[model samples]
Each structure stands twice: as C-alpha cells, then as structure tokens.
Target: MIGNKAVYAGWKAAGMPDMLNGDDHFAYIVGYSDKTVHPQNGITRVAVATIFFRLLTDKVRDANSTLTNNYSDISRGIWYDHAVSTLSKMGIVKGDSHGRFGPNAPITCAEAMTLIDRVLNRLPESRDDLLNGMIQWSDNTDTSKWYYLVVQEAANSHYDDIKSDHHEKWTKLRDTRDWTQVEK
Candidate 1:
C-alpha cells in the first residue's frame, strides 16, 4: 500500500493544484496532530472522506452540505463531519450494519473502489456484465467478491479515457483557481 506523502506528491505532479494553505483552503490529505502524515500507515475512512470531499467542486458540496445521516459514531463538529455527511448524502460512503461509521478504521480495498465508482459515476448496472471483461489476476478471480466488478471495470477502462478524465478535472481546477495555494 502507498503512503499519504507519496499520494500527495503524485497528485501534485499530475497537475492537481495544491490546496494546503490555511482554513480558507481545503487540503485533500492532512497529517495528524503530531505534524506527520504517517507516510507508511494505511489511510483511514475519515481521511478518505476528506480527500474525496476536497476533490469535489464547491457547487456540489454546497448543494449537499445540509444533508445528514444517522451514523451513531459521527459527531456534529468533528473535522470530517461535513465531508462524511456530504458523501453519505451523495451515496458515496456508508456506515456498517451496526450503524457505525468507523471513521478511524483502515479502509479496505473493496470499500475504496466502491467509493471511487460512486464518485466517478462508473458503477455498472449489473455485475454479470463485467464478468467477461475481468482481468485475470491470480488472487482476483473470485466472482463472489464484492469488489470484483468494480475492480474489473477499473482494469478495463481505456488509458485514454482515464487520462482525458483526469486532464479535464485538472484543467477545470487550474482555470478556476479553485484550489488553495500550498504553504511554502
């Protein structure tokens, strides 16, 4: 698994504008109170929520900001509260069967892929359709796995399409100066 610092550097190199200034800016990832991003540690669910929420346009966020959920673990004024609420409203994130959001839990691969699919609007209408397109990784052949179809869909996405989509978002952010400046 990649670390937070590497992910941040990669995104910056890929034309994602820095958004790590003060309170006016929205950082996609942030370090813990110890002033370290824990480069080798797995990312938590709340961190993922914050990242995706920062990646969203302000218009979308504003539209969904008032929406709320019933996750027992989420308090109203936490750092990730708004992000979690917005994502839950958009159906990009969900709590467990016990109605717990598990904010600090290390997110699983399947859960991450599901969030990606939801945010990208790439979820297939039927999992059966993706079986034929599946890539045959030795450990990934299990059709019953919940992530099977989403993983296959990601694997099958054309390189050009992915590049184009990323470029489009980058260009939009750049043009609008929507992102905050990183502190030097």
Candidate 2:
C-alpha cells in the first residue's frame, strides 16, 4: 500500500478525514464495500466503480439516493447502487456478458489502468502511438498486455523514473539483507 499512503496523507493534509486507516465508511461511501464487507485484501470491481464515480462527483454517497442497476448480481438497495449507477449512466463501466458487475471480484491490472487513465482525464492515444511506446517488461512485452497504452503513458509521465528508483532501492535492500520477503 506504499503507493496509496502518500495519497492518504495528502487527503489528511487537505483537511479530509483520514479514512484510509481502516475506516469502514470510506469503503462504504465509495461503494468499495458494503460497510460490513471489507476490500482490504485487494482492489475489487466494486472499488473501481466507486473510484470512477468519485472522480466524477463530489457527493460520493447519499443514503436517500436510489439507482437501478442492470447487473443481475446487483439488486436494489445494495450499498454500491448509487456509485455503480452513476458509472453506468456515464458509460464509464460495464457489466460482463452475463449481466454481472461482479462487485466482489478482484480487479485486473488492465481494469485498474483503464480506470486510472480515465481519472487522469487521459484520452486514448492512437494505437500507433501505443505501439511506438512499447517497452519490455519482466514477464511480457508491453504491447502484449491490453493495458499497454495506459502503462506507456504512465511511464511517459515519469512513473518510469519512480519505478527505476524503487527497483534500485529494492536491489540495495536485498543485497543488504534488510528485507527478503519482497514479492517480485
């Protein structure tokens, strides 16, 4: 959660509630969870939907708001109804062919990248541009992944330097035996 910590701190510094530290309302308000359920294990489809809604609106939640969802798995009165409905109306999100939003399903990297691009107000670059910017990844070539453009744009926006710095730090830490449990 290192990536999110800075954002959390910034939110707190901006006079917003420090909701990132186990605040159930944060998840519920954003439709990432139903208050009773938690998404701490990972990002989920519902969380993506919630983030989309939040990026587009200031009023994140309303107890009196009711939104009809087309997803077969999402019924009326669900905690995510408002956020999901807003995203649906904006065409920012879609359900599976089976008409399921899969609220509890873990979000894929491509999905996360797409959402982040949208949040950043990034329009899709041409396929040619994406192809031209392709870079090699440890496991796969950038173009092989569906999120190639999103990732490439992220790198172009300076994430590559940040990633390299982190890699160097991790390598140094590994050599020093200060940490060995690093995953990849």
Best by lDDT: 1
Candidate 2 local distance difference test against the native: 0.50
- Root-mean-square deviation of candidate 2: 10.0
> Tens-digit lDDT track for model 2 on 28-49?
3433245544535676797768
Residue range with the least summed lDDT across 10 consecutive positions in model 1: 167-176
Per-model TM values vs. the true structure = 0.66, 0.52
Question: Which residues of candidate 2, in runs, are more than 4 Å off?
Answer: 1-40, 59-66, 131-134, 138-145, 158-184
Candidate 1 lDDT (Cα, 0 to 1): 0.64
- How many residue pairs clash in each candidate at the backbone level? 0, 0
What is the C-alpha lDDT profile of model 1 across 1-184, one tens digit per residue? 3443211111223443332222355567677788888867678999998888888777677878843679999998887899999889878899988999999999986787777666655565444344343346666677787777666554453221223333211111112221236423
How accurate locally is residue 28 in candidate 1, as Cα lDDT from 0 to 100? 74
Candidate 2: 10-residue stretch with minimal lDDT? 167-176
Which parts of model 1 have CA positions greater than 4 angstroms off? 1-26, 131-133, 158-184
